[model samples]
Target chain A: AQSVTQLDSQVPVFEEAPVELRCNYSSSVSVYLFWYVQYPNQGLQLLLKYLSGSTLVKGINGFEAEFNKSQTSFHLRKPSVHISDTAEYFCAVTNDYKLSFGAGTTVTVRA
Target chain B: DVKVTQSSRYLVKRTGEKVFLECVQDMDHENMFWYRQDPGLGLRLIYFSYDVKMKEKGDIPEGYSVSREKKERFSLILESASTNQTSMYLCASLSQGTNYGYTFGSGTRLTVV
Candidate 1:
């Protein structure tokens, strides 16, 4: 079984400031990690995923996440954030076929 | 590009009504999932179908059922619509051996009154 933990429920940042959303997961063996973003009233869109080969994976909208095996963490980071980047981000892990999601972190960007 | 489409963007149903939510994926993916998104709870999987007529229960599956009669379509049924069942429902599909994750539909916001 796999479980994901997103520490912060809400994160507020000003426009153009860098932001990082923390995510942690626990599993017995290898797993696939993913970060998904959901805009207001929209479905989830895959931000990035870490399957194999690469520890640092980049996705759309200039967002990136690094997988740390020692720390059991996959934290999402963006160099600079915009108001349009505000959305709910979820961290999920799947050991087999089923994916388990964290509570979620709501990112609110301000000008 | 893979596309998952949900039947409705918004829906309203009265209590005790039998409600159906439809999802279709053009990718011909073998896996289809039904999830409900709430305020505090991010996304809870209700049910998933690996293939036509083959289904599996997810984390939370009470008060809900799923049908996959065809390869490209999956349906979620609310046996009895209650206020607690009101939520944002999402449908997603995954290819058999794809590296990328599931492709999600736009989602249906169902409000049970």
Candidate 2:
């Protein structure tokens, strides 16, 4: 069975400040990792994905993540955030066809 | 662009009532999935259909049932609605291969009283 863990439940950052949301996964087999962002009352949108390539993956909205196989982590980061960037972010791992998701981290960008 | 559409945005049902949530995908995706989203829990899969009339149980499937009658339509059914079942229901679709990502619907918020 595969599982994902998001270390932070909530992260608050001021406008123009950088932010990072940590995620870790446990899987016996090889896995595919992803990051998704959800605004209030909206569906999830894909941020970035790590299939098999370079460790660094860039995504929409100036978001990026690095896949560290040794650490079993795929953490999302943004150099600078805006007030509109406040949303809930989720990290997911796919084991075969089933996808395991983390608890989610709420990012609040204050003005 | 891929689009997945759910039938309802908000629904209110009484306990013990039968409820049905419909989902349709225009991308002709072969895989369709149903999930429930909660505060702490990001998204828990309820059921998924790899093809028409073929369904599989996901992480949480005890209280829900699913049907995929056509290639583009997948439905989630609640035999008997309960307060605990009230949550945001999401539908997603993706291509068969690994290179593509999932496209999700707006989601239906179901509240059982």
Candidate 3:
């Protein structure tokens, strides 16, 4: 069984401030991690993915995540966020053929 | 680019009524998945299909059933709709496999009264 844990349920950041959404996973086999973002009243869009590459992967919207295998973590970060960046972010891990998603974290970017 | 399309944007059904949620993918994706999203619960997979007539139960499949008769369409069924089943249903498609990126639909908001 593979499971992903998103450490934060809600993250509040001022506009232009940096933010990080923490995620961790537990898996026995090779890991595939993904980040998806959902704006209000919208479906999820892939932010980034880590298959098998350099630990650091950059994604859309100026977001990036570092996959630390030893730590079993993939944390998404942005140097600065805009008010439009407020949305729900999801972390997902693969279990063989299926993808298991975390509970999710709501990012609230306020000006 | 892949486009996963859910048939309905909003649906209101009475309890005990049968509910059908339709999803279609345009990219000839081999993998299609149905997930329900709720507050605090990001997205819980209900069922998925890798190929036509082939379906697999996901993490949560107790109250849901699915039909994938054709390669491009996947349907989620609530045998008997209930208030607890009210949530946003999302349809997603992966071109290659789980390792590939997923394209998601806008979602269907189902409300069972």
Candidate 4:
């Protein structure tokens, strides 16, 4: 079975400041990792995913995440955040047909 | 781009009413899922269908059921709506072999009175 744990429940940052959200997972087999963002009253949109090949993957909205296999972590980072970047983010892990998701981290960006 | 469409953005119902939430995917994806979102609880999977007439229970299947009569459509049924069942319901679809992950609908916020 695969499960995900988001280390932080909420993060507050000033506009144009850097932010990082921590995520970790545990699985006995190889897994696929994903990061998704949900704006207020909106559905989740894929921020990025790590299937294979590279340890570092970039996604839309200038967001990036690194998949550390040894540490079982997939942390999302953005150098400069905007007010629009304030949203809830989720980390999920899947080995086969189903995915297990973390509780989610809510990012609130203030100007 | 793949699009997943939920039937309604918001709904209100009285207790003991049977409610059906519809979802359709234009990409003809082979898998569809239903999940409920709550404050601090994130998203919990209710059910999923891999193919037409093929359904599987997810982590939280109580008080809910799912139907996949066709390839592009999946419906979530709340047999008897209760106050506790009020939540934001989200639908998503995924291609069988792709690694792009699931495309989600805007979600339906259902409030039961």
Q: Which candidate leads the pack in DockQ?
A: 3
- What TM-score would each prediction reach against the true structure? 0.97, 0.97, 0.97, 0.97
TM-score of chain B of 1: 0.96
Runs in model 4 lying further than 4 Å from the true structure: none
Q: TM-score of the second chain in each model?
A: 0.96, 0.96, 0.95, 0.96
The residue-by-residue lDDT of candidate 2 on A1-111, one tens digit each, is 688999999999999999999999998678889999999877898999998889999999999999999999999999999999999999999867677789999999999
Every model's DockQ: 0.74, 0.76, 0.83, 0.74
Native contact share for candidate 2? 0.59
Q: Say which prediction, candidate 2 or candidate 4, comes out ahead on TM-score.
A: 2
Quote fnat for model 3.
0.76
Q: What lDDT is reached at residue A88 by model 2?
A: 96
Residue pairs in candidate 2 whose N, alpha carbon or C atoms collide under 3 angstroms? none
Model 4: how far is B43 from its true place, Å?
0.7
Interface RMSD of 3: 0.9
Runs in model 2 deviating more than 4 A are none
Per-residue lDDT over B23-110 for candidate 4, one digit per residue giving the tens place of the 0 to 100 score: 9999888889999998888888899999999999999999999999899999999999999999999998986565567888999999
Per-model CA lDDT versus the true structure:
0.92, 0.92, 0.91, 0.92
Decoy 2 TM-score against native:
0.97
lDDT of 3 by residue, B17-107 (tens): 9999999998878889999998998899899899999999998898899999889999999999999999999998886655577788999
Interface RMSD of 1: 1.0
Cα distance off (Å), candidate 1, residue A85: 1.0
